[model samples]
Target: MKVIGKHLTVDMYGCSFDSLDNLEFIKTAMLEAVKEANMTLLNLSYHKFEPQGLTALALLAESHMSIHTYPELGYAAVDVFTCGDQSRPDKALAVLKSFLKPEKTKTTNIMRGDFGSQKDMKPRIKISIAPLRRVRNTSARVWSLLRKK
Candidate 1:
């Protein structure tokens, strides 16, 4: 089997509510994690939801990393995917864990771009009707209009 990249998905439970809800803290932690993992950051985006919760994403040269938090549930979901050996996705996850201080964590590692052989590969088809940005903008506009009523 040939592997091209590593993807780590983490589910953190019993995390600090304050830390999960803090947008600045999450942004800072993500930046630190990117640096620690030796990943080149191309862009970063984050949003804090009304009432609570937060979401952040970092676009890296190697790949991408993201975090979504539910403060009321004391949980955070994190994803780190990196191509090439120079970047450490595990190290990035570690940095997030340190900041959130979760009492329990469940992690899964997936090897990306791994295809054993022609016979072993299964054919699959995916279709997208609209770009993500367009969907998001439309949804936001609808939500805003509903809230104004």
Candidate 2:
């Protein structure tokens, strides 16, 4: 598996907060994200057990996009996990960030698979990262590597 991920400091403005309280907005946003990511939407699972929090997950063929909200703190956590065709996650993330607007964000790159100790049977990585080619500091890379492992 080839994976490139970004944790974005999205700009979560009043719009994000408004969306959290409205079911229609959340559904629309999630559906739009699915289409933008070019992923098939299998289903959606929403949880509102906690009045102050809301969790919405969009199940996609590529992977998943999840959002957790903290209405009290006026904050939210978003995750886009795509395995094959790494561009999907970045694209989806970009849309999400643009709409949500997080203040602080960080992305980590992960190369899964290719555990080939021998000359043969090289593992195939499914991700392609041409879309997420951004300059990042070496220290950030090290931190992400350590955390991912």
Q: Write the per-residue lDDT of candidate 1 for residues 1-149, one digit (tens) a residue.
A: 55888999999999988999999999999999999999999999998999999999999999999999999999999999999999999999989999999999999887788876334245557777679879999999999999999
Residues 32-62, model 2: lDDT tens digits:
8778878788899998745656788988766
Best model per TM-score: 1
Question: Distance from true position, residue 115, model 2, in Å?
Answer: 3.2
Model 1 poorest ten-residue lDDT run? 116-125
Task: List TM-scores for all candidates, in order.
Answer: 0.77, 0.60
Point to the candidate with the largest lDDT.
1
lDDT of 1 at 92: 95
Cα shift from native, residue 81, model 1 (Å): 0.5
In candidate 2, position 129 carries an lDDT of: 63
lDDT of 1 at 136: 96
